[model samples]
Target: MTVENASAPPSTRRPSAERAAALAIQHLLSRQDAQGWWKGDLECNVTSDAEDLLLRQFLDIQDKKTTHAAARYIRGQQREDATWATFHGGPGELSTTIEAYVALRLAGDAPDDPHMAGAAAWIRAHGGIAASRVFTRIWLALFGWWKWDDLPELPPEVIFLPKWFPLDIYHFACWARQIIVPLTIVSAKRPVRPAPFSLNELHTDPRLPNPSRRLAPVNSWDGFFQRLDKALHAYHKVAPRRLRKAAMSRAALWIIERLESDGCWGGIQPQATYSLIALRVLGYQLEHPVMRAGLASLDTFAVWREDGARMIEIAQSPVWDTSLAVCALADAGVNPDHPALVKATDWMLGKQILRRGDWAVRRPGLDPGGWAFEFHNNNNPDLDDTAEVILALRRVQHPDPVRVSAAIRRGVRWSLGMQSGNGAWGAFDVDNNSSLPGKLPFCDFAEVTDPPSADVTAHVVEMLANEGRSADPRTQRGIEWLLTEQEPSGAWFGRWGVNHVYGTGAVVPALIAAGLPAAHPAIRRAVTWLRSVQNDDGGWGEDPRSYLDEDWVGRGTSTASQTAWALLALLAADERESEAVERGIGWITLAQREDGTWDEPHFTGTSFPGDMSLSYHLYRQVFPLMALGRYLRAVQQGQSVCGTSDLPR
Candidate 1:
């Protein structure tokens, strides 16, 4: 394949390598599942576009009512300048604004429609076409709204870098790495063509005349990374023919091996999905079986309804949800023989990874022993899942000796191996704190890195303690780190769940497990902090803003899940007999619906502190079960129980 002449006017010539890449990508696509779905990055947020589109489709409100309602929601979100934010009331992001505007257009609003004008005006006002993120620009370029040269190069050769090197494939966080792999091929090819429509009004300058030079200052980290990328591009251009071919082939195979049957590299998340598509455009063929299956898999990810069509989540949470539910019920004092408990245990036992997954890289020689968020994501198995799964399994009566023993050993080993040198554990991988990845200018968005954190470490300690191995040095070190990590305000910064409530809920139990006296200063301080935050509603709820604003700690409309979390912390501290625990349990019981479930409208789980939020539907059921079970047990032991009459009006 000949390099496209940067000096020569844009040519129609298709490089042979580009064709080969496309064929390879298409081949990858053919491997998708019979169900039309492609797994990749879901790109989660408070205003998840996927959720908005899903609601529209599910309600079958394609008529003016639906349009008007959604439009009202979208319009209300627009800033004074007409741009919308990915996060609540934050700076306007071009991609979010673009998606929102497109949704509005699909809602039957015309370009000149006042709201439409306002959005377009805002897009232009924010450097319009020029100021968007690389991913955003890539989408626009795909349809000819933006030029290819304006983007950074992503040569596949970068994948060949050794794990020890800076900017190596391994240096990137898993989420970022997944997208970058396919993007490398796409960037190197730099394919551009015309689109069906013009986005002239969306740009501050004519698309053709718009400057394509790198945006960040050369002295800045982003600029440095960009320059390094350009150098990689030059190296790819002149590399030995044999070496280049081998690198590309290796990269292609690496991607193919990881392709889930659902046409997604991992599951139908957007990053993997888009990467799959980019690979296809690079010349992968459909009949190659892998590509064919992958393409078919993409179809399963599409969710169509009367109002509009969007993507179905590539991943689901039956295993994680059920396990957490089982634990919650058991902790709440539900009989181990409860039908739900038995079923959940049976399901979880069947779901254990008996063979090693990608985690084997850092934790080699350990048997596969962790649970994944989705039933299928073997490669991205989580440390938290392993801990929680083991905890749940331990509570089950009559677990299979062989399976339980084996799974626990594997999980314990994995968790221990995942501990960083600093004696803490991260959610997924260990030692994922490269200084370079986050410094890249292109990574202005939050969450380009992962490090060991207090919450995950506490979970590890609790799990180890349950295994009767709390005295182990590794476990002791983790406990020590957690004790040190507590905030001056007496709370631990929760990395995975919502704010202080989650951190406190996790820490108090872990401390208790580690043999902290109930009256220990740290324990008492945590108890006092929780009690102070209890709402008049006799429940506790903290907004996501708690991640940003300390003053907002424990402030929000009381919800069943948060209340349960607070209750769990109090109970773990031997405070189950306290007025606060009684009130908290009452609030949860009162909030329960006739169906035995509680209302949980808010997303309580977070990934990259303050950026992406998640709602585990089972959080409401499980946490309350845990709190109530603990409370009931304490009361059965002659501790005072809060009466239903004491619940908030």
Candidate 2:
């Protein structure tokens, strides 16, 4: 908390790291709310902003201020080529561009305007509307700009499928299921609002907007789904009227049942947006309590900036942010009984989900005690957040030890129960890796399956180790599974964060904490991999494109968050004295701003791998402090960061 210059030379390691860590800890503490929570802005691409405007237009509730502000934000995301991309420094994406263009049009931008005209030209050159994804087309069809028949058919009757069925609601990823169930009603009803303006300029040819294409070979998955879709379309014309009505009613009820206390379905904009549309189509009036509450929840996602641009967060992350903040603060020399740590721990305990959610479908006997990513997503407590929160809680000496212990026990039990048969943990659901959802023609945007990833499994493993369960049979199995998942290049795939850096950063520490030796072959290979990929400037950054191109793996311009992640892995492996480690620390200290924070403009967080990227504003702060704190501890204690376990229980 004292004033010091982090700009000290690299040779002066202790002073520089100490000053930088102190500045970060103070800055982070300043950000904590009175109720003991830290929330950073969760930023995604322009699609959320576009979809928000589209939702208002569909509901006939467009306000001038919101429209202008949203349009400004959307325009600001446009690329030099007049197209929008899903992530920073990525190629132009057809779907994102189309959505942003439509949102700007809704804000009253004329097609003939210079910027608008350039975007239209780019859209036309890229096969126009036909080249966009199915989700984008669905939005277009709602306004009569595209025909409903051209899109994939999603019959509401699918909701009647048994839980044992391949494509049942439970089989899809939790986020996808929330949106899919409501979309089934939308697809069945096919209601279209009248368009206020024509999108002829966005079409390659107005007369044949959706050109027909030949299906793949019958033996292929695409062909089978294509034929199935055709049959479903045929069923749409002749299905029994009574049965269809009953199915739509069932789907509508399903959507309403999952609404959280704050009226959000999963604290995600798309899920809430589509659910509202489904209910509205089924005759739910705008003034109805459920409808009104749902509408109000969408407003919470808007993050109005000082420049008057209104951007929309795809999902909120207070719970996730707070848990990591606690870990960072506690690691950075904050006292175990410090008020900040206690309040954060108390807040986290209160946020634990005590009721069963959709994850219980597969584990009916397991108790509910996991944590969700958002403030009010009780129905979907993710394993990643739960594991991290438990670790954070373990670091604090809370006033009520019984309560903390009880919470930790429940969390560990739930986490252990939620593990897949393969001995790994996914973010949300267990064994939610059904391939049917991805093969379906309707799901072309977000990842529909929730498979176990190294990062999540690592967190759970680390949490289990901290709880003295390191030698448990289940923990050993998880460790074995992680060993098998290592890539030939010595990195693991990062499902939730940006590429190899995040995954390797997460796995190394967990492995080390679980009793793996510093010189283990796997650890050595990972260290070599990390050092080989370090930026010439001595920090680490991985571009989102690594999810698609192997050439880009573990390569990008340095950022504070990513550099910290790599350093954490190194320090955990007893590499505090290595040149790579020292250079990384120097980069972090020199990169620190006068205000005790680092500026990270790249999309370091992730949602759907290559399809969607995110920028968690707090990642730039929390991770660096955590890494620095661990490094200082290693140096001061004359031991590995993991070996110095005298902080707290």
Candidate whose lDDT is highest: 2
| Error at 199, model 1, angstroms | 2.4
lDDT of 1 by residue, 315-343 (tens): 45555666666565555445666555665
Q: Report the backbone clash tally of model 1.
A: 59
Per-residue CA lDDT of model 2 for 177-231, tens digit only, reads 8899999999988989999998999999998888997999999999999999999
Residue 116 lDDT, candidate 2, scale 0-100: 91
lDDT of each: 0.65, 0.91
